[model samples]
Target: MSSTQLRANDPQIPSSADGSQGLPLLVLGALGVVYGDIGTSPLYAFREALHAAGSPSVSFARLEVLGLLSLIVWALTMVVTIKYVSFVLKADNKGEGGTLSLTALARESFRGRPVWILVLGVIGASLFIGDAIITPAISVLSAVEGLEVVAPTLAEWVVTITVAIILALFLVQRFGTERVASIFGPITALWFLALGVSGLVHIVEQPSVLAAVNPYYGVRFLVVHAEIAIPVLGAVFLAVTGAEALYVDLGHFGRKPIVVAWFAIVFPCLLLNYFGQGAYVLTNPVSEHPFFEMQADWTQLPMVILATAATVIASQAVISGAYSLIRQAMHLNLLPRFHVRHTSETQSGQIYMPQINTLLLICVVVLIISFRSSSALSAAYGIAVTGEMLITAALLFVVMRRIWQWSLLFALLVIIPLAIIDVGFFVANVAKFAHGGWVPVVIALSAAFLMQTWMAGRRLLISKTRADEIPLRTVIESLTKKQPLTVPGTAVFLTSDVEGAPTALLHSLKHYKVLHEKNVILSVVTSSSPFVADNDKIFYESFTPHFSRVIITFGYMETPNVPRALVLAKKLGWKFDIMSTSFFLSRRTLIPAAKGGMPFWQDRIFVALAQNASSATDYFRLPTGRVVELGIQTTI
Candidate 1:
């Protein structure tokens, strides 16, 4: 299909054709994708920060406890509310929000902005991807670790179960998660309710702990012993780690729904839990289950099960996010061409990419075997999150100047505080470099290398092939002496553009110089976000003087249903039943062609990505028997 048509703002969104149910599903599903990581952060944030402060006795009299709460609330206000909600949410490009999206905006607008800024933005986004890998690992382990409390001896068993659960989730991705997603929102909603309930019970028991919210406690705690505070701040920032996920995933749910959901349910529950954890710690001298200690002993099983399910759901959200990010990478020419399978027909946001799933599964397993506990993963988590925050800061600067036309003073006021706070987390996490942070660094480095290589290779391929990409009009005038003969059926060419490629037409002529049985239809398929509109459809009346051309677009949310698209195209005038007509693809297999143009290294990389790209038949969803391949050699 066409890419231009699927933009989220397309009128197709509220169309009578889609029915009224799609919007609500999209709103909830988007919330899951966006909040999964942040939602699960509560599992360790307060606990780790508390544990780091020398496991201070649970009491309102203890200044460390009050300081910890103050740090938690302020960090959330700065990193999550101020930076992400107020600033990053406004830094969007066509409803698409991400580090890369921001980078593009910056590069396009502030072309000469300091090179270091761009570098930081890339590093940030790349690291976020790495964080994505570890999120699944740590979140799952944190939840399943509960088994130890259930049966201390079952710790090993818990690991096995956690691994198995993760494996099953990845394996079933190809089958699609549309049906499962229908309930994810409701289930996640319930999980938040449980967390709130647990927090409420503690709040009622010890009302005085609420005083920790006062800013004075945080200030005194930090200055009293700033040395220890440095490391403690490391854990404090963890509370707000996934805050950016909310901004990046804004496209999934419109701003209104996400804002509504956050204020109505998500935000309150999170605060209560943070306060509740503080209350529980303040009351209990010995908390075997600091979190479960916040709840009654009889309620253990329910919390355990809810926590387990919630964590798994959270991990799954990152897994899906990795898939979506990679898909976007492919579209933007920063990744090798991989098979992208549409997991849902009705819900465009649902997608399953195999390469990404396998990577997540492998990395998560490795993370568990190496770090072994939620505490260890803690060292790895903040680095990626912090790095991503810096990248988002740079991106927001661009959006302010370019899109919003805000003055530099205004932009700096918004971004500087973010840089300061995130820089602290970054430095603290650097101390953890040798601990468990290496995994995320390794993943980020790998992703960055892959992206650079793919981009370098594409630049070479596109540049080399530019001269050879024969104009469509030129192809028709030079080759076709008579008008294209109309026949019993339409013959569609899998064209790169609706018009172009003398080689394609020449091949068509070489195979059958004169049309004998089918009308010629040149079709161009475009890429757009999974959930967008379709409006740029066009049928050319005069191209190459002999052949007719047509363009069709598909939202990334929609699968390349060739037959379905053909039916729609036919209704618009080009008649071809995909089930009967053959689909053709031009594949260039690069051999070390010594020296037409591209750099030597580029030639090799091109060969690599070309070799790695999905087979056209499967990528295009063509019936194997009915598909045809044209092995064409490019000058490069």
Candidate 2:
């Protein structure tokens, strides 16, 4: 059976939960988390366009500046405002949004399992991870580079300071950010306010720059200078790089808050800044640093400090988003489980994953040391963002047709234009392959390979393991007749396959030759929905005198506590006491056989991953003293 089919048959759906606070607070939170990446883009996006335009003998005239500004404004309007806020956010899966959530929702629209859709989802997730790594390195590098404007002598210290700051950021992750997180929203709001005030000052000087809001300037520039514009489009593409964060972080902040924050604060501030930069550039033809040049000398240092803080905030959001994405992937069996720590008492979304944080920090440091400047890193940035956007557009098309059940013509009307624009951005970025763009492509391809291998290897391992095990019913009947020595306390055997006798139970029966006074077979299931109803969380059935079966279901978004779930069994007339119950778990040691499911090399990779997976004792929050792990060797 397909993964989607298995999920469909797993559990019951719960009522949608509205986790929103008041509208004002929700918008404040959205500004900090959802808008950080895109909000900080004004720091380098316009500068990069100017650099791209001036290179290779292209003239960056006043009309060219206007054209680029118009393009920037319209791209934000089309990609972020219309596509994400107006359409994609409305297609959430049980009030949750992201590629995986959307993938699960889209899978339900079709009658049969579609492997292609699953592959698309995997590719999109891999690309997002690639962006996560690049975002920190580039954002920090760009922000710290602002020091050069304040003191030319400090240019030499930019990379060192950036690396130090990044190291500190990752190191503090273990302690959690709950204490300082409250300030992120207010700080980002102030940053946006500063951006608008700074830009409006310059924009009033050159009123003609406001004419760029006309979309005609954007189309005319592209048509007139198609050759120059084609390459510039790659640089222009940077303006909307973080557009995907809106949908990726939809679950953390509800739709209403994000939409309100975008229309009210983020969109207007970005346009004003971009227009301000354009206006400054038009009057001073020879100036390269228009962003800092327009700022008065007294405010320049403060602007740099605020820009650095904003970029740090943006990097934090990307890191947190990665944790959420990988957690979902683990629940879906695409990757092995890592240690997940809930940092906040009231907020379940505030999570810390040490392994992910460490790996990302190492990669970000390497990128900073190698690239050395934001200009070089910028070449590596757009490709991953555009590729992810393309995949999202493809998935969105399927969602519009299959889930929303729109007419063919209507779906085409909405998605075709987006597909064309996304494709244009992606094709433009293809030129970056020779100039450091290969970094994210390589990272994304490696991630995709690992996910596919792990998923395929899991299926094979489960099939092989199940082939060797007997039915639970058969074992129970024989045990009842034979009547082994009865222990005093209750025993719970954790199993992936509820139909068959658990490997741990079989080992316990074969070696110890003892059955407890009360034997409960427990199976834990993860569903595709965000949350399962409490009423449908547990199911129980009695087979023999002392034997029974219980199943507990948890949503992908929740952390499972096995013993706590068992406490609910009292409602069904089963006397349950955590002190009296001993949990039995199977610890599989995979051995690669010549005639096994996967190729020998891939099997080795799977084995390495399995060996590194977090122990179930910690994952399920089971008691350390009462749990017994019986190890078994399995050929796969």
Candidate 1 lDDT over 402-471, as tens digits, reads: 7789998987887787788888878877777787777788889877876776666666666666656777
Give TM per candidate.
Answer: 0.86, 0.96
Q: Please report the TM-score between candidate 2 and the true structure.
A: 0.96
| Native RMSD of candidate 2 (Å) | 3.4
Each model's lDDT comes to 0.69, 0.86
Misplaced by over 4 Å in model 2 are: 1-20, 56-59
Q: What is the lDDT of candidate 2?
A: 0.86
Candidate 1 lDDT at 107 equals 66
Give lDDT: candidate 2, residue 277.
Answer: 89
lDDT tens digits, residue span 1-636, model 2 = 111101112334433334546788888878888999999888888888787777623446888889889988888888888888889889888888888888887877788858888898899899999999999999888989888888989999999999999999899888788887899999999999999999998899998999999999999988988877766788888889888999988877778888999999999999889999898888776665677777899999998899899999999999999999998898888898889988888677788998889889999999999999998898998888998888888888888888788999999999989889999889888888889899999989988998998998899988988999999988988887789999899999999897999999999999999989999998999887777766677787778668888888888877788887766677676788888989999999999888777889999999998898888888888999989999999888
Clashes of each: 15, 0
